[model samples]
Target chain A: MREVFGDFNDGRSAAAHQVAVRLDTNGLNITSEGAGVLQHWPYADLRAIDPPHADAPLRLTSRANPDARLRLGDPAFVEELRRKAPHLFLRGLAQPNVRRNAGIIILTLLVLGLALWQGVPRLSAPLARLIPMQWEQEFGLAFRDRLLAGARTCQSVAGTAALSQLSERLTASLARPPPLTVVVADRATVNAFALPGGHIVILQGLLDKAQSADEVAAVLAHEIGHVRHRHPTQMAIRVAGIGLFADLLTGDGSALAELAGQVGGMLLLLSYSREMERQADAYGRDLLQKAGLSTAALARFFAHLAAEAPTAGGGKLLGYLSSHPPLEERIAVADKDEAGEPALDAAAWQALQNICD
Target chain B: MRQLRVNLTLMDDDSTPSEASAPLRLEQRGRASELLPVVLLNTLLNIVTLSIYRFWGKTKIRQYLWRQTHFMAEPLEYTGTGGELFKGFLVVFFLILLPLAIVGNVANIYLDPENPASLFFPVILYMTIGFLIGFAIYRARRYRLSRTVWRGIRGGMRGSASQYALRSLLFWVSNAITLGWTYPWMQFTLFKRLMTETTFGNRSFQFDGSLKPLYGAFAKFWFGSLFGMLAVALLIWGITFADTAVSTRPDFPFSIAQIAFLLAPLILWIGMAWYKAREINLLASGTTFEGLSFRMDATAWNLVSLIFVNGLITILTLGFGRPFAQLRVFRYVCDRLSITGEVDVAAIQQSSTAVPSMGEGLADAFDLGAV
Candidate 1:
């Protein structure tokens, strides 16, 4: 290597001494003009501290005795040394090597696009189904208990009997009915939520707003449809999988479990996706039609909620609204659905309406 | 094309004429052309690997950053590898993520369901995590320092991570109890604690200076915040009075409370800016290593303007201007700060401590550890 100006540090303190560095058959040698002899480091023991930038301070240390440090003022000296011994430096993936870097870039983009669009969705679907029913039930029940712990459950005997009768009437037409347990919670929020494994919560405010039992049954049927489709599990799996994929790619593992926990608690609270909502509504319509109940009742309830939404106050109702995005197309389909007769008689409708009285 | 210049002054030393010695100057030599290519490649790799490329990608960035920083015309070096970072993250993920997830899910199931016990239990967990974060921050810094090499000698930190963490927690607790009035003392103590333990080669750093100089700025901020809060409370009371005595209309346009609410964030932002600038300046000036001291001539107003512009750019471009903003901030800091005094480098020998296998785990968890 050509002679170049350099600095030597003993690694003891920050004091730097100027020296001349050159490479020969005997390896790199250092000499101070006035001080005479400085140091002679063998090539085998010399370790190059690669600089990230193209032109940076050339720092090298002795592998055998790291306390010996050499800093070259000339980048050319580093270039010469690198040319002579490429094996001494660790390869950086981000270093600019046009042809190879280009290939990696192209491959990376394709994988990211594919994973986002198709791969993740395809993967999560089966994974969601694979989770055992026992786990899902425990998961669902645990979440539901925490969610409704503060709310009082209406246990009026007549109201309970009326609700059970209406549920029986509505579900009797199903091909294979799920084991449904419907509860009326004593909260004034105009909302209802369905949990995995056939648990449905209907708020008192929803019943108070309904003029007839058929209207309330229509809502329950929709929730039952959600259970039948196993939408909660699918939704939960999809969200968690996507998040984990992103985290793994970024090499961020620290917050993984914490995020998963947060997502779990919030899962039931998420209003079902639009497609799921529509499917649930369709299921309700078919079940109602089989029971000779009018689908117009479901359409009427949607319209009523939409009308009251603008006047609704507080963050509680906002949660309900966000989770249950309204679809006018579904409402129109609901209105056009034809059925033979009202399944609930006047007395049963009134009793169901007073279920939370 | 730009050329690399040695910038050698060639001035001679009279005391030791036999051995020529020169003064060293630090510089930032990063170029956009070099950085952009790496960034582009990394972005693509990040996309392809579904973010797995990021661990390596970050290494490349650090490599570029460290190389760009020159001390006495010699480029500082970064020897960290992408694979090492990836492995570190995975180890933490499997070891920490799984347990945390289980605990969190269980807590969410039992404690989140409206029970008073739920609230009380989660509070304990939060406090525990908060306390652990202190230790994690210290450990992360130690890791970073150990990884940083200059003139072949790596920088390092001493003292137990646990102790530092405990000290941080104590400060945090006191800050909470004292209505945040103990902030200056807390900041000063922590700065001294971390810096004094810092080492470049075998030599340790020294932190001097008192919070007595910062009290003036802090007091101004504290009083300003209090005034802002009182104004907000008064405005709320006035709005209620207006609603009752005057016209209780369906819509009350721009009441005193609404206006105060709008201004509260701005007030808080200003206070935070002032305190942050003063803290940074104090920290820089008070720190010394190998008989060399530092000075940061950055002012609060200058910082406020920098922050305002950075935020505006970020917002206007929808985050695309982030790199440019970051570059500008780096330049600003480098320009404003200068190291003074002398260092006895020839006397200092390489430290003989084994580097930690992995660190920055907590920083990764919190998403604040990257430097």
Candidate 2:
């Protein structure tokens, strides 16, 4: 019989007792120096509290006396224990259920990724449409008022008449024109925005940059296209949906979750907006042709922008041309001049130019 | 590693030399080299799994650290599993965060930012988050305690987590209202609450620490910070004056105020660390359990250096050397801490507190798990 010397704590005291352990078919026999046989721990009930490591002592605890502990540092004892009971060594990746767990985790990730990518955008558009038109209009009006609170708004009577004339002419051929609220603001940035619920903002800079009234009318037509498609409301819904889904999956508003939501939201919105811009361009051209305005005005304006600076209208959060499809591509489709009348009379055009004076 | 055996009465005499009844010491047997492979593997797995494997990775690390820590010549054991942590996360995600997020988003859509009434929902949201964070800290501590076992007897914490969270929220509000003067009292009260409820086996710990010992250090910290801010403001004013009055120090490329601005955070951190060391020492010396009284010998310089070096190691290695930094902390604490008084181990029985089925969900989400 091979006897192994070790330390035992019987759970009764803090004292450590030196004992001699002998391995047998039944179990381990522990004997104190003066005391006779102390306890018998069956092999089946034995468990290693600390996973066996080369540098760490093998600490053992048994089910019979759960509070009792045994520490065996001898290499031979470890070898004997391993040979007798190899099941105690299974840990971490070596566990039998590792493959099953990995499979479950992979499956979960795929489902989550697919849902975020395909589910959110598809759902948000329909959800946006479901919101009552009255509520949407109220929201858009409040949002627009707050947005333009600091900017000076130009309300010249002659300019207003000219603008109304141009707007009526552009929408005259539509089966049912939208309830548009157009405002010209005094700002030095060349941009126009189509806000939710048919709110259109024309910057003074855009009027200054346009070579003719036809160019200004072309931009207005594009914004009207956006209003027709209800793009602004859909975009707001998309942002909210992505945020909610990211919170659902990642939880905690953690950095990782926030990053995933932001990057995913930006990429999705960019592509969706690019597609919306293309649609608006096509719709705007059709509107111009139907209204007898020059269809090639918008293309010329885009070419002029491209020639001036590729990033002329770039600024944080409100970049007009940055997120749009390349100007060259847009210009390609609208560059051809079809024989058409002027969008406004010469006097009306001059009045419109001074709209933001 | 040397232990001195003496009668329990020896600790009563303050006049007697500390060497007469040497306190018990903790030992750290783990090495960074031993943990390097495991941490590296876990980090790699975390990236591959989109951090889904982090719960398991944390469990593995805790198991190793627990086993390496030796008290009374026996190693501690960790019984927590990764599945419990994952379940906890899923529960919090679905039941709490998801619903709150949806409501907040919906409210944002409907609410007008220009309207004063719209602030109500946002205020509610912030308050709820604050309360949840407090709740998370208490529960996380409870979970850790329940999983920590020594000599087959589990360490446990007793007390209602909700009450603790309420107290935490109250302290935060009080701190803000008092301009942070109530901070020392809050720390002492909270630490006392935590320590008094902590148990090793069936023997509950007692904390007699008061706010008195903390005020002296806190006063110095407060005054020092005030002066630092005043100095910074003066320097800024000087820089602004110099900018207006041209040709003053034109040879010098950078303003003195700019340099002070850059160094302010570092100096402030050092000062905070100094006060923190004092706080830790006072708190530790006030705790006792089963006739065992503890003491910590943490010094300002040691703590500051430890923090600086650990930060450097983690940052320079791109976080791959996190285990090494953790090891340094464990070693530092073990080397400085000591215990006195005789332990009646026979009296301590297995703890009866029920182990929490789930793990640190909110803590993980909040990134407050500093382990």
Candidate 3:
């Protein structure tokens, strides 16, 4: 009989016993000197505890004797067992369901990619529309307060009247305008942005830079367009959607999830959507035309901005134009030469310009 | 010479070994070559499955490492499955993390930043996360122990994870208030707590060590950090005022001091390695189970070289060589550790502590434990 020397742990104790194991067609015959077959482990009941390797032994246990372990150090025995019980070696990616597993994995990845690329944008607009306008306004006000915590709000009486007058002129053309509040912030940056809930902030430096009242009216019209379309609400929904998607992808709250959120936030902020910008520009132009104001001033303001500083769209100094549609594309939209009334009188314009003082 | 055959059921009747048995040393039987192929395959599968396969991959690696580790002439066994880990992660993701995320998002939108009352939200958030980390460490250790088997009897741990978390949180607060001077005491307390709860089958592990031995190494590390910070401040001062002060006198030794200041971190790291080696030795020597006590012979130079090489391997391979790095750590520990006295094999019965149905979800989420 062909026999192999091995060590056996009986599971009841931590002691190891040297034993001789003879392999037969039915099972393994474990025996010691002067002892007839102590136990028999059928080939069908045998399982490898560790995968077979070149250096280590093939550690096996029987289903019938769960805790008892037999380690065979002989290479020939492991090679022979491999031939008899091929099912033990089929593990990990080499299993019979490997193809199905791989297919399912690939399909899942494809679905996830598609959902992120198309589902978020498609779902966000309707989702944003479903939110109550009152709640959005409240949330937006709170957000604005948080964002502009230390900044001074510009509040000259005549300047406030002139600003609301210009905003009303643009909003009056709409069938149902949002509750717009056109406030001036006493900040030195040439920037203006519309917050969620109909809040438009025009900075003092923009008034200082504008040569005439028409330029200020043009900027106000642009902001009113953003509010009317509820672009900020849609943007918030999309950003939140991306964040949720990232959280799901990272399993639980991890550093990677936070990183993904930050990256997605930066990308959304830096780009701000060219298509959305175009919609706002087109709406602003239509508003200008309906209000009987000349679009020519907007083009002139952009031209002067381009000529004075070619680096306007690239730095923080020109925060108003940074990440805006290319100057030429915007200028082309507002380059019409229609004759119209000035946005405000000379007296109101001077008062508006000195609002920060 | 006649061989004696012992039946599996006969040893359950309490035939204990003598307390004065010879000392035994643990041996590592794994080869780096054997581990590499599995790790490489796992990395590829992780990419293919977007890391969803990592649970299985980690289980496979643990299985291999456990099977190759030898104690008292028999290899250890790991019986954990990938499905358990996956289910655990899913439960934590849906139950714990989702609600917290919703609360956080809502709080950010509504809470006024300038209000002192709103500070409660952030403090609560950090506290919850810190507590969860402590809870995860305990549960993770418990899970690993329950899966580790020797001669068919599994290891286990008893004690409340919540209690551990609360104690750890208290220690963290103490550490901050004391400017990290209480770190050695914190480590000793935590380790003692963990060891007191550890069990192998029916036998319990005990940690009997003093706090005085740890203070010497900790003092060296603490003073080294203080001096490193001082050097950094001096270097910054040199850069800011050197133009005016040193330019007037061309023969100043400020340049030499500048170089020394730049090299302070390297010196500190070397000193830290020495302290780490001493700490490990002390901790290992203090652990006892039944009649067996452990001793580890670790040196600062060997530890430093091992860390340097392991770091190099991990970085050079872009983390694919992590299994190899872990293999080196296991081999180093096994080679250095010596066990005195033998376990009374027959005296130990199978552990009856209920095993966790799932695995270490929070640990996976927090990226805790190397192997």
Best by DockQ: 3
Query: Per-residue CA lDDT of candidate 2, range B279-310, in tens?
Result: 99999999998778989998889999998899
Q: Which residues of candidate 2, in runs, are more than 4 Å off?
A: A1-51, A58-77, A80-94, A138-151, A170-177, A188-190, A208-218, A243-265, A278-304, A307-322, A326-342, B1-23, B98-126, B220-247, B252-272, B313-324
- lDDT ranking from best to worst? 2, 3, 1
Q: In angstroms, how far off is A207's CA in candidate 3?
A: 6.7
Model 1 alpha-carbon drift over 4 Å, by segment:
A1-48, A51-83, A86-179, A183-193, A201-357, B1-26, B31-34, B112-116, B224-255, B262-268, B313-326
Q: Give the local distance difference test score of model 3.
A: 0.78
Per-residue lDDT of A52-126 in model 2, one digit per residue for the tens? 887667888788987678888888778888777675677876755566667766886797777667776677668
DockQ of each: 0.21, 0.17, 0.23
> What DockQ was computed for model 1?
0.21
lDDT (0 to 1) per candidate: 0.69, 0.78, 0.78
Chain A fold similarity by TM-score, each prediction: 0.67, 0.76, 0.78
lDDT of 1 at A101: 49
Candidate structures ordered by DockQ, highest first: 3, 1, 2
**In candidate 2, which residue pairs clash?**
none
Q: Of 1 and 2, which scores higher on DockQ?
A: 1
Which pairs clash inside model 3? none
Error of 1 at A282 (Å): 14
Q: Residue-wise lDDT of candidate 3 within A41-63, one digit each (tens)?
A: 99888877876677777788999
Worst 10 residues of 2 chain B by lDDT: B7-16
